[model samples]
Target: MEKLAASSLPMPTTIIADAGFDSEENYVYAVGDEKEPRFEFLIPYGTSVQEQTRKYKKDIQNAKNWTYCEEEDCFLQLKI
Candidate 1:
């Protein structure tokens, strides 16, 4: 997460997901150690329960301290 944060890339202001990330444990885990960057979580729409997972998926383990917003919707450009 630190590497990603320091990389020469545009940081995202917000992120969204399903009920997967609404857990208190994950919320606490998402909280960063440094005392500057204030990352927040944003859960995607339709779920309002918190889930505690031992670990995040391989792809998203590095996506720490990010808030999930639950109000956004997505559409496929072209589904196959």
Candidate 2:
């Protein structure tokens, strides 16, 4: 980011990255703290995307089969 800001080239209007670059710090950096963002970004959460795949869904221990209890802020594995 420092390099990009210091460069003489024109600022890009948008940025696209794979799941590998997805992180809270990256998101905050791309979008400035102020009202307006520094640049637009398109990044998807890695886990969310993985969960939709057939391989991930077939796993019995997958989080998708577990229930998230907001009140307890924990995941509950209900017995069958």
* Candidate 2 Cα deviation (angstroms), residue 15: 0.7
Q: What lDDT tens digits, residue by residue, belong to model 2 across residues 33-77?
A: 885789999988778787888877667687777889999999987
12: Cα error in model 2, Å: 0.7
Candidate 2 ranges with C-alpha deviation above 4 Å: 55-80
Error of 2 at 72 (Å): 16
Task: Give all candidate RMSDs, comma-separated.
Answer: 16.0, 3.7
User: Residue 22 CA error for candidate 2 (Å)?
Assistant: 1.3
lDDT of 2 at 38: 90
Question: Pairs clashing in candidate 2?
Answer: none
**How many angstroms is residue 80 displaced in model 1 relative to the true structure, after the best TM-score fit?**
44
